[model samples]
Target: MTKITYVEPDGSRIEVEAENGSTVMENAIMNGVPGIVAECGGACTCATCHVYVDDAWTETVGGPSVMEEDMLDFAFDVRENSRLSCQIKVRDELDGLVVNVPTRQG
Candidate 1:
């Protein structure tokens, strides 16, 4: 399991044990972590699970693909580091991944 930390809009942090091959959004939903609506249920069709990856982890988390970028247009406060959590698969290399949840759903 990888360790993924999600910071809420209020600055509260939630650390979850993420299963390898699963998605960051799934881990958050499983843990009942707030701030991620995940209306599309990991389908990558919605921006409800948007998050800002920590600057330090940007290279590792990677940039959004064309499809993801298109969907992000519907997200609130989209940033250079913003990503759809469903697109972020958990991996051993991402053990300490940290992301900040936005204040509201997109």
Candidate 2:
């Protein structure tokens, strides 16, 4: 299991053991982390699972896909580090991954 940390808008942090092969959004949903609505589930269509990858982890996490990038146009408070958590697959190397969810979704 990977240790994933999700920082809420109010600075609250929720860390959980992420299952490998699952998406970050799935981990958030399974752990009941606030702020990730995941309206479209893990389909990568609604962009409701938007999150901001910690600056230090961006390079390793990589960027969004073409569809994910287009869907992000509907996300609220989009940022340079913004990403669709559903597009991020969990792995052993991402043990210390950290992401921040916006206060609201689009």
Candidate 3:
């Protein structure tokens, strides 16, 4: 299990032991973390699950794929570090990953 720390826009944190192979968005939605709507489930269609990965962990987590990149374009606060959490599969190598939930999802 990887420890994924999800930070909200207001600086609140919700840390969880995410299962391997499950996406960050899946964990967040299942754990009932607000701010991540995940309307399209784990499909890279809706950007409601948008998150900003901490720069320190970007390379470790890697960048999003073409489809995820396309969906992120529609996110509320699109940034260079913006990623659709659903596209990030959890792994032992990604332990302690930190992602910030966007202020809004639309």
Candidate 4:
């Protein structure tokens, strides 16, 4: 399992043990973390699970898929680092991955 740290807009932290192959949004939603809505489950059709990966972890997480990139455009307060958490599959190499929740999600 990889340890993923999610920092909320208010600076609160939610650390979770993310199983390899599971999406980051799955880990957070399953853990009942408050920030992520995950409205469309892990389908990458909804932008509710949007997050901003830390600059250091961006390369490690890589860029989003076409579908995810399309959905991200609908997210609130998107940024260069914005990502659909459901598109980010956890892996052993991402053990210390850190992503920050946006101030709002819909």
Candidate 5:
């Protein structure tokens, strides 16, 4: 299992063990992490699962895909580090991944 940390807008942190091959948004929804509405589940059609990739993990996580970038247009307060958690697949290399949840969704 990969360990993922989600930091909430209120500065609270939620750590969860995520299974390999699952998406970050799935882990968040399964673990009941707040701030990720995931209105479209892991389909990557909605921007509700938006999150900010922690600065330290930015390069590791890489940039959003062109399709993802288009969907991000609907996200609130989009930032350089912003990403849709559903587009991030969990793997051993991301054992300690960290992402920040926005104050609100699109």
Candidate 6:
């Protein structure tokens, strides 16, 4: 299992054991991490699962796909690091991954 950390807008942090091959959104939903409202589940059809990839891990996590970038247009407060958690696949390399949840989703 990979260790993924979700940081809430209020500064709260939730660390969970995410299985490799599963999307970050899945782990967040399974762990009941606040601020992740995956309205379309892991389909990547909506921006409800928007999150900011922590700066330190951006290079490791990489950028979103064109399709994901289009979907992110609807997310609130989109930024250089903004990413839909559903698009991030968990893996051993991301064992210490850290993502920040916005105050609200799209």
Off by over 4 Å in 4: none
lDDT of 1 at 68: 97
Per-residue lDDT of model 5, residues 44-93, tens digit only? 89999999999999999899999999999999999999999999999898
Poorest 10 consecutive residues by lDDT, candidate 6: 39-48
lDDT of 4 by residue, 1-106 (tens): 7999999878989889988989999999999878799988878888999999999999988988888788988999989899999899899989999999988896
* TM-score against native, each model: 0.98, 0.97, 0.96, 0.96, 0.98, 0.98
Q: Global lDDT of each model?
A: 0.94, 0.94, 0.91, 0.90, 0.96, 0.96
Residues 6-100 of candidate 2 have per-residue lDDT tens digits of: 99999999999988999999999999998899988899889899999999999999998889899999999999999999999999889999999
Per-residue lDDT tens digits for candidate 1, residues 9-85, read 88899999888999999999999999899999999898999999999999998899999999999999999999999
- Count of backbone clashes, every candidate in sequence: 0, 0, 0, 0, 0, 0
- Which has the better TM-score: candidate 1, or candidate 3? 1
Question: Comparing candidate 1 with candidate 3, which one achieves the higher lDDT?
Answer: 1
Cα RMSD for candidates in order: 0.6, 0.6, 0.7, 0.8, 0.5, 0.5
Global lDDT of model 1:
0.94
